[model samples]
Target: MEKVSEKVRQIIQPGEHSYVFSKYLEPIAHVKPGEVVEIYTKDAFENRITSEKDLPSQILGDYLNPQTGPIYIDGAEPGDTLVVHIIDIEPDRDWAVSVMKESFGGLTSTDLTPMLQDPLPEKVWIYKIEDGMVRCNDQLNFPLRPFLGTIGTAPEVEALSALTPFNHGGNMDVPDTKPGNKVYLPVRTEGAFFFTGDAHAGQGDGELCGVALEISARVRLKFELIKNKEIKWPRIESDSEYMVVGSARPMEDAARIAYSELIKWMEEMGWDKFEAYQALTQIGKLHVGNMVDTYYSLVAKIDKKYTKLD
Candidate 1:
């Protein structure tokens, strides 16, 4: 990971953080469109629960992911679109953490999915970062794949928890929220109250255990506003694909919402509704974001070639 340079127009340190997305929270800093900014973020655990002996049930509080800011974007207003271009994400620490707590994982007897059986035993695994790889164990090492786990603009009236992912885009945990991708969020209040955090050094699809390679990070981002371009859900654009995220209960519902939103976006881009639905039926791809949060998240994606008019 390269060091942040002087070219950044603003630097938001992880001094004051928030655990909820609310229109009422005071703006940490104000930024204009097209200005580059650097944000520092803590891991999902907020750097608590360091070793195997530090049990999450004892060390952690009610909140999990601590977000950096509710950055007020100049000229942004309700019904507008906030465009975030991720420039880069670099791990701020040499080590990362992942853990399994009692009744907290997807496969375990979580509070949402109560089972009569016993919950999974708690455990912790601290991964080492070296040579651009995350050393999981002595025998396994994989390349770094950094991304933000929670990111979104505030909802108009609700003060939602940072762990919840909904229309306002909270803890989606989608690995696609990485460097080089552009995330488009709907603005529900003035200035778009943007918040982001929960840096993952790496994660697999579905974030199976309800955790990833949690790490602190320095993220570079650029903001832009698209006036009057309101989207129902968060949309992501990469060099090759266009993706939309949806969060809901009953995993299948999340999938349906994602596909529905993708089809709607396609219709807005000139494809007939039926045609877009048919096209998606033939070529759309699905990526699981998380199955362990308050609401499960799914991403519907399609290649850019399929959307071309030529």
Candidate 2:
């Protein structure tokens, strides 16, 4: 969908140095249960990597994936759910950059994986955004499928990095989070402090590389609080389907968690015991979000039509 510029109830700007999602972080802005907001988020590297000569290894010391706003929503509390509607995602800059991380990706392990092998060389690719597409290169080109790579409500426990996806919805990198989609995040604290960043002009499933077509984006969103719904994981819904998102290590566990959550949610949707399982087995699709983060993410999706059985 083409980016739309409309009125928003509030506008939130990005903060510096603080990239993690935690309940302790103070709320930047507050909104009612149903409100639209325009948020400006920095690129994953906070717009530090502008040139190929600029080493992400050197520039990204700690300020990575800087998100905008832990926006407070009124009437939101623990055990409730925050429903985020993706109204629009517009690239703020004409250029975007992607990186091949030196030591931290699916290819090798650094602090997280802990291996003796040296990290890979940092490779940067700058793309020019034009004609409704981001030109990767002369040989490689694709449409501008921009979406937020990281979005989450603050976690109740310890502060978590914007690099990992958790129950509160951190860096899931799910490609399904585009315009017209609604992501239901479980509320962990009062007001549902939420943040978003890491916009990608284009990315494939299972973001095999650590980096995507990372770009700064002006994201338009609508928020609503689900008063009584208690969700165990992040759930997303589009015009046609419902998706359950789960993040974890070892990859398959993430997949398992997503499908399991889908089944559980389906049970609550008026399906008899095991009926949801039987139905999902025939109509579900597993979408790989990314495998290169601190935790891999998987999304289980089933078309809504399948759920309306006679």
Candidate 3:
């Protein structure tokens, strides 16, 4: 985590044409490791829907989740690991919104899950924010915990949509991707084309409605490089535990991948392989990051104290 003496903290914003995250895309900005940056990102709809008559399906034309950049971090290269420390995420506006399109969401009818009934109506929900909580209704209130819905590096593939989360990390929508959390992503391209977008003011575990409290935000973060770490999936480090993230079609397989990576990490910390597995089986906690994404994301977590090999 080398520090740079640049006088200003670079702030990046997505231009009108900035639409996707792909390895072929050129970097909009470059900063050395440990250089702090601020990002101003549009909501998933490009912040075009302002009234009740506006529909999410109609607004999301070719642009899916709008991203701020593929910022280049110098000295990062393939076979290394890129570490991102989320410094802060604050809602840019006073209100946030969520939507259910023609056939999206966990419980709604979709092309993937055919039903004999008509598709659900396009609905939208606006939550008023104050006192650090969103007022959904008299009985339902959600606390404000802002996070990025998509944070990923360009994969080795030519161009992958920002819809799926994989080794390079995309729209994982994990609430754990918050302030003070550390996310580890593999470096596939030189400088690790890291991109972020789709800020959510608050989200439930499954995102059952396919949308959270979508809001614009000022995201503050810093980057570092872990040379030669060679990790497979994205990992997260919180105050109390370490989490391995896996995203796949069947949630069971995603859970398997998360557990698999956690075990590998434990083994790397010098514990006996069998003992690590046994310890994890007894103490590991499984978390659902998002069940509404194209690929379900699961996280396996264990306390650092239990992972001490010495």
The TM-score values for the models, in the order shown, are 0.96, 0.95, 0.94
Which tens-of-lDDT digit does each residue in 126-185 have in candidate 1?
Answer: 888989899968775778999999999999998999999999999999999999899999
Give the root-mean-square deviation of each candidate in angstroms.
2.0, 1.9, 2.5
**Model 1 CA deviation exceeding 4 Å by range:** 1-6, 13-15
Model 2 over residues 70-169: C-alpha lDDT tens digits?
7888998888999998998999999889888877777787677788877788888899999988887777677889898988898877889888798889
Tens digits of per-residue lDDT, candidate 3, 1-310, equal 2233444475666455355567787788887887788788888887887666688767668557888888888999999999998888878888888887877788867767667777789977778889999876787588888988889888877676776777678989888888888999999988888899899998888888788889988888888899988999999998889999999989999999999999998888887878978998899999888887778899899999888754
Which of the two candidates, 2 or 3, achieves a greater TM-score against the reference?
2
Backbone clashes per model, in order?
0, 1, 0
- Please state the error at residue 44 of candidate 3 in Å: 1.3
Question: What order do you get sorting by TM-score, best first?
Answer: 1, 2, 3
Model 2 steric clash total: 1
> If ranked by lDDT, best first, what sequence of candidates would result?
1, 2, 3
lDDT of 2: 0.85
Output the TM-score of candidate 3: 0.94
Worst 10 residues of 1 by lDDT: 1-10
Clashing residue pairs in candidate 2 (N, C-alpha, C atoms within 3 angstroms): 44-65
